[model samples]
Target: MTHTFRPRIAASIAAVAVLGLLAGCTGGTAEETTEQTVTFWTPQATPERLAAQEDIAAAFTEETGIEVEVVAMAGADQDQALVTGAASGDVPDVILHASTQTGAWTSQGLLDTEAAAAVVDTLGQETFNEHAIEAVTLDDQISAVPSDGWTHVIAYRTDLLEQAGVEVPTSVTELAEVATTIKSELGITGLAFGTQAGTASATEGIQSIFQAAGCDLVVDGEVTIDSAECTEAAELFLTLRNSSVAGDFDVTSARAAYMNGDAAMLLFSTHILDELAGLDEATPATCAECVDSPTFLADNTQFVTVLDEENPAQYGAILSYGIPTGANVEGAQQYIEYVMSNGYVDTLGVATEGRIPLRNGMADNPTEFIDAWGALGIGPAHERTSVDLYGEEFVGGMAEGINAVYLWGMGTDDATLAGLVASQGVLAGQIEQLYNGAAAEDVTSAMKAAVEEVQASL
Candidate 1:
C-alpha cells in the first residue's frame, strides 16, 4: 500500500534535471532488479550482529528463496543513511532502533507502522515489551518490535558492602546514605560518576533520580522541574556529586572505576552482565564481579524499563528493532519472525543479561537470572520513584533542568539543595540553548515560562 512518502517523491519530480544527472551517473545503463532482495539496516549491524542476522537470513533465504542483504552503514551515517534511503526509495527491509526516537520520526512521516504491525502480530505482543511497542505507535498503530529489552537495575558490589560492614540499600535515599558511609569508611568516593558530561548512559543514571526523588521532571503536560518534587531530584544529584568516588564520570570512566574495584555501587545497565563475562577474570583487575542482587524498596514491586514495556530500565537503555515498510516486506517479516523464535533468542541473552526476552514457551529456559526475576514481586529491581514522566511538555522540560542541576553540582559546592533550587532553571536554559541554538536568556525564560505554566495547570 502506498504511504505518505509516495507523494513526497512524486512532488520532487519537479527537480527532473538534478534527478536525471544523478540517476544517469550511478547505474544508468545497468539493469535494475525485477526480482526482490531484502536489505536490512541497524546501528548494531556489525559482524557480531550479522551472525544473528545471517543465521536467520540463511534460513529464510533457503526456506523461502528470498535473499537478505545486511548493511553495516557507518556510525555517523546511520541517521543520515536512513533519511537518504527513505528519501531515495531504497529503504532497508528491516531496521533496529531505540523507540524513543520513534515518536519524533513517526510524527515527521518517516516510518511505516502497518508493515511493522504485521510482524508484531505474528510474533505475539507478550514476547515484546508492550510499553515500547506503544511508544513506537502513533495514533494507535505499532511501529517497532522490542528487540533487546533493558531496564535500569541497581548493581552493587556484594563483597565490598559485606567487607565494609555496610548494609545494602533498598531505596535511593538509602543508597545515598550508604555512599556517605562508604565514603567515610573507605576514604574513597563510594559512588563513581561523570567521567564526561552529556553522555547517554550517564545521563540515564542521572535521570533515574527523577523517578526516585518522588518528584519527576514532569507533572501532567507541563514542566514541573522547579517544583518541590523535581527540585529535590536535582538535590539528590548534588548529594551524588559531593559523595561519589569519581566526579563527572563518563560511561567508560564509570565502568572502569567500578570495574577497578573502587566504587561500591552503580545504578547502571543491568545488561552489564554481557561485559561481566570473563570480566572478573580480566588482567590487572580493578573490581570484583559484584553479585547480582535485584533488591528493591519494600513498597515498589515492578522495576522501570524505559522504552521497553516488558523490562524497561536496566538503569537506562532502550533495546528496540523494526522492519522498514517500503521494500521486500516479506523478507523483513521473515527476519524479524526468526529472531523471535527459539533459535536466536540466546544471541540476545548473550548481549544483554536475562535482560533480552525469551521466546514464548521458552521464558523459563532463559538464563537463571530471568527465571529468578520471574519470581520477584518487583522482579529484579525497583522502578525509580519519579512522580511523572508520561507528560509531553513536563518530561522534556524537567529533564533539562535536572541535567543542569547535576552537571553543575558534580564535585562542587553548587551540589546542595539550595544550590539546585536556586540555579536549576537558570542553568537548565544553557543546555536548552545548546540543543536548540537559542539565546541563553531565552532558554532560561522558556524554562521559567514552562514551570509557571505547570503551576497554573496544577
Candidate 2:
C-alpha cells in the first residue's frame, strides 16, 4: 500500500489524449482499445494487511485484466481526503470505509449509488448480511457494497464469574449487579469499556447500550435523543463505567486492563479475540496464569453476544466499498465482484478477527463464505481459527449475530442526518457528560439539541 497521493488530474489528461488518438484511428471506445485501471483507497494500511490486499488485487488483475492500484490511507484522514478529492474531482475509483460514512458521502454527491447497487445485484444481494446491506441503503438504493463487520461483545472471565457465584448477564440490571459482585469479591476492576470522549470506542460503547435499550437517536428525520429510553440507556452506561477501572479508558487502555488481569469483564469488539488468545505478539495475553499457559484467558473466557433480553440486539459496525461519482464504474465493479467472490476468503483472511464476512457465499452456496470465514486463521503471530480456539457453536452464533446487529441511524428516513450526528460525535460527547456527573436528563437534552443543530446544518 502506498501512502503517496497520486492526483487523478494526470491520469484524466492522459486518458483524454488516448481517447483522441483512438477516435482518430479506430473510432472505438476507450474501453475497447485500452486496459482499465481502478484506484482503490483502503484504511487497512498495516504492512501485513496491505500485502494481503495487494495479493488480492494481483489475483483480480490476473482474472479480469483490470489493473488495481491499492493506496494506503489512514481511517482518520479518509474523510478530509474524500472531501478534498470530491471537490477536485480526483477521488479514487472505489473506497473501502465504515458504513457510518455511507449516507453522508452519498448526500454530498461523492458516491455512485447506481454503480454500488449494480455490484450488489451482480454479486447476488441474498449472499450478503441483510443488516449490513440495510445500513448502506438510502432512498431505496444501495449506497455502497457491504464488505465485512464485527459486533461489540461482552466478554467475561468464566473462572472469575464461577468463583464469585454469578451467572452470565442477560439484561442491563443483571449486568450491573454482576460487575458489582465481581469487583467486591475478586478485588479487580468489575468491567472495562471506553469512557474517553470523541473516540470511536466511547461512541460505539454508548451506542451499543442505547441500541440494546431500544433508544432511538433519529426517527423519521426527527431528533429523538431525549426520550425516556435514551435517558435510561445513559444511566445504565454510566453505571457500567463507574464499575470500570478508575480514570478514563480509551480502547487501548480498556483492552489492556482486561488482558492484564486487572478487569474481570470487557466490553469491546471481536477484534480483541486475537489478542485474548495470545496469538498477536504485540498485544499478547499477560494474565497471571498466562505466564504458564499462553491461551489461559482464551480458554476461560465466554462472550455474551446479545444482552438486554427484552430488546435483544447487538452493536456492530460494517465496512463497505463505495465507488466514487466519477470513477471507472465498470472496472470498479469488476474489482469488487472479484474480491467478494473468488478472493473473498483471502481478502477477509487479512484480519479475520475484525473482518467478519458480510457476504455469506455465492447464490448457489449461500453459506460457503460464512463457513470458510469460521475456518480462516486469526492473529499476526502463529494464527489459529476462531473454530479452533472457541467451538463451532460459538463461531456460528457470531455469524448469525452479524445479520441482526444494530447501529443508531441505519434503516431510517433520516440516515444521512444520523451519519452526520455519529461522525460529529454528538452522542459520544453526551456520554462524557454523564461520566462527569451531569444529570441524565440534561445529557439527553444536550444530545437532542446537538443533533438538531446537525440536522439544521444539513
Candidate 3:
C-alpha cells in the first residue's frame, strides 16, 4: 500500500517526511497468520495512556476473543508512522489520528471505507456531531469514525484586559491596534502567538489569522496567498510581532509566556486551561497568581474565539479512528463500533479536556455525553471539569466557539494542500525579514513568489 499525506501536512514536510520515505517498505508479520488478532495504533503514546489503552484492548478481547496489540505513537509522529506501517504491510487494524487526514488516506487506498461507514451506520449517524462526521466524509465516502474535537481560542487574562480598559479585538485591524496598545500601556507582551517556521503551532497561529479574515492558501484550485486579504493578514502578523515580547515563540514558550504572566494573551487550543489547573503541582512558580492555587483561569482568563472580524472562524483539530484496508476488517469494525458506543465516554475520559465529545448520543438522549463531558475531571485536582477550575462561563464560551472552526484545506485537493505545506516557511521567513528591517512590499512580493512556486508543485 502507498502512503499519501493530506493537505494538513503541506507546511510541515520535515515533521511528516516518514510518509513519503516509507511508502514502499515491505517488512511485517503476515496478515493471514494474524487473522484472529487485531493491531491498533494511537497518537496517545504516553506510557500511562498506553497502559490504559492496553487495558481497554484487554476488555475488548474478553468480549470478542480477538487478541489485540496496542501501539502508541506521538501525535507529531503518528501521521508518518502510520504511512510507514501501511507501506511496510505492518498497518494496524485500527489507527487513531486527526480526522483531517481521512480524505487523503482514503484516497491513497489505505482505509477500509466500507467498514468505516458500517461503524457510523450502526452507531446512528445523527448521534455524532455533524461537523465531526463531515470532516471525515469526502466524495460521499465515510473515511473514518469520529471521536473527539478541540476548540482553538485566544486565551487572555481578563484582569489584564479590564485593567487596560480595552475589549478583545474583533477584527484583524482591531487585533493589531489593541495588542499594540496593551504592550505599550501595560509594559507586557501584547500577544504570544507561535512564529516558529514549519511547526504545527506556528501554522495554527498563522492560519487562524488568515482563516478569520476569510483568506485561504488555496481556494477552488487557485492559489490565493498573494491576494489582498492574505497580504493584509501578513501585515497584521508583522504588526503583532513588533509589539510582542515573546519573540519567536512556539506553542510551549507561548503558553509559558502566558502562564508566566509575561504576555497578556496567547493563541492556544482547549488544553491550555487544563494545564493551568495543574500549575500548582507542575510549575508552582510559573505564575505569581497561580502560586497559591489554580487561580489563573478562575480569576483572570477569558477565552475568545475571534481575533479578527468575519465572525471568528476558529480552527480545531478533530480526532478520529481510521481502519486500514489490509487489517482484520471484522475485528476492527467491532472495535470501532464498541469504542464509539459503550466505551465512548470512558475512552474520552482518558483526555477529557482535550477530547470534547463529538458524538452527543442517540435521539432519546442527544446531549447525554455532551452534558456528561462537563462533569468529568481533567486536571491533577480531578475536578468535574476545567470549568471547575476556570469557571462555567469560560468553558461555555469554549463550547460556543466550537462551531466557528474553519479547516485550511477543507475542499481543496490533496496535492494542492501538500504543495502549501511544502512551502510553509515562505511567509514565516518573510515575516522574519520584515522584523529585521525589510520593507512590507518586499516581504509581500517574496511571499507571492513562494506561493506561485508551491502552486506550481501541484
Winning candidate number (lDDT): 2
Residue 106, model 1: Cα distance from true site in angstroms: 1.3
Backbone clash tally for model 1? 34
Candidate 3's TM-score reads 0.83
Of candidate 2, the 10-residue stretch with the lowest lDDT total is: 14-23
lDDT of 2 by residue, 314-387 (tens): 88888999988877777778788888887888778877888889998888888888788878778884257887
Candidate 3 structure quality by residue, lDDT tens digits, 1-458: 11111111111101122233211122234453334666676787655445556666666666666666666666556666667777777667788887556766877888989888898998888888776777788777788888887877877787888888889877767777878988988999888888776566666777776667666776666666767777777778778766686568888888788878888887778777667655335643278766676565446777776554345567777888888877767778878887777666667666676778778766799877766666666754444465555655654565556545557665336433633553365556555666677766676677667777766765
Better of 1 and 3 by TM-score: 3
**Full-model lDDT, candidate 1:** 0.45
| C-alpha lDDT of residue 203 in model 3 | 65
Flag regions of model 3 displaced more than 4 Å.
Answer: 1-36, 75-90, 197-200, 283-285, 306-312, 380-384, 414-426, 437-445
Give lDDT: candidate 1, residue 258.
62
lDDT of all predictions: 0.45, 0.79, 0.68
What is the C-alpha RMSD, rounded to one decimal, of candidate 2?
Answer: 6.2
Evaluated against the true structure, the overall lDDT of model 3 is 0.68
Q: How do all models score by TM-score?
A: 0.64, 0.88, 0.83
In candidate 3, the residue pairs with backbone N, CA or C atoms under 3 Å apart (3 or more residues apart, or in different chains) clash, namely: 10-421, 10-422, 11-421, 158-300, 171-309
Clash pairs, model 2 backbone = none
Ranking by TM-score: 2, 3, 1
